[model samples]
Target: MIPLDEARARILAGLAPTGPETVPLAAGWNRVLARPIAARLTQPPADVSAMDGYALRAADAVEGATLRLAGASPAGKPYAGTLGAGEAVRIFTGGFVPAGADSILLQEDATAAEGHVRVNETVMLGRHIRRRGLDFAEGAELLGAGRRLTARDIGLAAAGNHPWLTVHRRPRIGILATGDEIALPGEKLPEGGIVSSNAHALAALVASCGGEASILPIAPDDPAEIAALASSGGFDLLVTTGGASVGEHDLVQKALGRDGFVLDFWQIAMRPGKPLIWGKLGAVPVLGLPGNPVSALVCAVVFLLPALAKLQGLADTATPTLRALAGVDLPANDKRADHLRATLTPGEGGVWIATPAARQDSSMLAVLAGADALVLRAPFAPKLAKGEPVEVIALAALGV
Candidate 1:
């Protein structure tokens, strides 16, 4: 058995970043950038007015100065001629500043007749004017690579005059659930049959991390059948729920071994999920998760999701852990690292207290759903009193 960090490193070491593709600006949201995006054109190509007011020479905009309204400049239309001494132009918001106009005497600070205007207040030079390239200059790097474009990023890219962008393709994942006794949800259950939900849960987790997930049909206990189905999925990554352990009915290893695959690691020393398997079959990476619902989701959050992020060119894949106070006196852990389901609430002095669930059965989905975080207990950790500091991983990151 290997440690959690070793398992994570092994998984990442065997994977490669996905290829890049060109997409339209409308489809670039939430996609990772393949290369740095540079501005195609300077913002505010020319000097423009920011407010609806009179545009005139700053030297002639002093108090009590009267000027003739030579012409008008509305948005998208510019005055054909330049300004002269004691001359002003009726410029609206976003209108291009007429040539030779040094500043704008605000409408609120001036009194205007039919063709003449009188300045009531002193005006400063270059006031209320948005200069050329005020926001971004041409050829400037607007956004760097490896950034996941958000709605705001899309708008910013559009402002840079980009109609399309280059981004990494979303990873495609194929999920398989193996067992004859398991049936999908909303189906009639046979005697002693159970509902199959691990595939659905795994799909949701994969999709939330920006991967394309497809749940395949269930496979029985036959090794040949499992191998055939697993080998033909054609996905970037293959994930199986059961038959990963060495039990009699464990056929996932038999079908995925020998001919065209290289096994990276098989198991790890951890609670809830220990019978995990990872390797490469041809060019596709295979991740074998446990059948237990909570264990499957836990392992997905810790391992599988990180792999997806790495493939997507994400900078960091570390799971977030927070410090909290224990609500009860917990005993020492064994050789296997433990992840206990618990609820976190505010305690005295603004510290959060975590209370572990009484029953941590891997099959209990209700308890897992109610849990806010998984308090991490290192292997062979000593006993702890109530109010002791403990590390916790939030379950909300799993999108449960």
Candidate 2:
């Protein structure tokens, strides 16, 4: 067994980013940008009025000066007339500033009667005017590479005249479950048989991580069945739950190697999920998980999510970690790092506290139902008292 950090580093190093592809802007939300998006046009293409008011030469609009209204200028349509001394154009918001106009006096600040307008207050030059390129200039780098395309990013890209964007393709994951003791849900369970819940859960995890999950049907304990599936090489990553330990039914390691997988690490120094297998099948990465439901899920949170993020060229690919206060005292454990089940609640003063559930047995699925986070207790951790600070992994951050 190796340290958790060292195991994580090795796992991350083995994965490589899949190439990029062009996707329609509408469907590109949460996709990482593969190329820089440059602005096609300047914001406020021309000097325009910022409000409904009069556009005139500020020098001519002295205190108490009266000016004749040249014409009306609304948005989209420009008033094609020039403003002369003591003359103003009736301009609405977003209308083009008429030629020879250097200022805009707001309608509320001026009085209009007939075709003339009176200015009682002084107006400064260029006031209430949106100069060309005020927001962004043409050819400016609007978005950088590797930036996640969000709704606001999409809006900004559209404003920059980008109809489609180059983004990383979603990683494809192949899920395989191996064991004769496991059966799919809704099926009749024989004596001592359990449902194969890990594959479905892993598939959902892949989808939440912005990847496609291709779940192969349950592979029985037979080596031939497992080897055939591994040899197919139909996915970017292969995730197999069960058959990773050294028990009699464990065949994932041998079958994967028979089908051409180069092994990385077989186990990590972590509790409830010590029998993790990381390797590669053909060119695709493979992760062998424990048979227990909670153990598989915990491993997925620590390992699979980051693997997916890395495949998509994301920089911050690890699970979301936060500093949270411990609500109760915690005893230390030797040898293995523990991810204790906990519920995180927001308390007063904007702080989050984690309360570890008393029942932490890996087979207890009921405890995980109400869990919102996993309190990460490092290996050889000292006994902790209440109100002690600790690191926690949020469930939402794990894409659960």
Candidate 3:
């Protein structure tokens, strides 16, 4: 049996990132940028007004000075004529300053009469004026490569005049749940039938990692049937839940072996997910998860998410973890590394307390559902006292 870190490293190293493709700006959110995007044109193309005021020469813009209003200049329409001596043009916000205009006399500080406006406030040169290329200039870098585009990033790209973006393709994953006694949700269950709940969790996890899931039909215990479904289905990676043990009903390994699948390693030193299996079907990575719902999802969080991050070209693929205060007295652990189900609450002095759940049965989905974090326990770890600092991986961080 391999260690968990070795197993995770093997899976991540065996895979390669997907290629890039051109997608419209509307579809670019959360996608990794494959190339740098430069500004298409200078913002504010020319000297424009930032406020509704009068455009005039800086020398003539003074306190108590009255100037004749030449014309009006609204947004998208510039004054055709230039500013002459003692002349002023009524310019609104975003309107061009027109030639020979160097200052803006705010309308709030001025009074308008029959044919001229009076300046009362002290007029400063270049006041209320937005200079050309103030926001960004042409050919300037708006965004760099390998950046994950958020909603704000998408808006910035649009401002740079890019209607389309070159981004990394989303990784494709196929999930297969196996068991003759398993039935789909909303279906009539037999005497011993169990609902296929692992697929939905896997699909959600895949989506959270930016990968699209192809949920295949559930395969029964028949070796031939499972083997046939394990064949290529145009997926970059294949996931299987249940039937990975040495029991007679366990046939996931036997089926994949017939298709030249190379088993990398199995049975990590973990409590719930010890029966896990990992290997490759040609170039596509195959992960065989335990039948227990909690075990399958836990393994997916530990292994599957990192694979998806690497596939998306993320520079840092490590899961986020933090140290917090323990709320209970945890005993010494055995050889197998344990990820104890726990809850986090606020303590005094801005301290976060992690309280381990009393019952951590692998088959209990309710316990896993109620947990907000996993208290990591390494092999041969010593007992922990209440209020002691311990490392915890946030459940919300893994999109649970």
Candidate 3 structure, TM-score to reference: 0.90
TM-scores, one per candidate:
0.90, 0.94, 0.90
Clashing pairs in 1: none
TM-score of 2: 0.94
Per-residue accuracy of model 3 over 270-387 as CA lDDT, tens digit each: 8779998889888778999999999998888888888888888777778788899989999999888889889999889887899989999988889999999989988889999988
**Local distance difference test, each candidate:** 0.89, 0.88, 0.89
Candidate 2: misplaced stretches above 4 Å? 60-63
Error of 3 at 279 (Å): 1.3
lDDT of 2 by residue, 1-400 (tens): 9888888888899988878899888988989888999999999899999999999999977779999988988999999877788899999999999999999999999999999999988899889999999989999999998777789999999999998999888888989998888788999875798888889988998888789998887898888899888666767788999999998889998887777778888889998899999988878888898988899999989888888888888878767789999999999878899999999988778789999998999988878767999999988999999888999988976668
| Model 1, CA-based lDDT | 0.89
Name the Cα RMSD for model 1.
2.7
What are the per-model C-alpha RMSD values against the true structure?
2.7, 1.9, 2.5
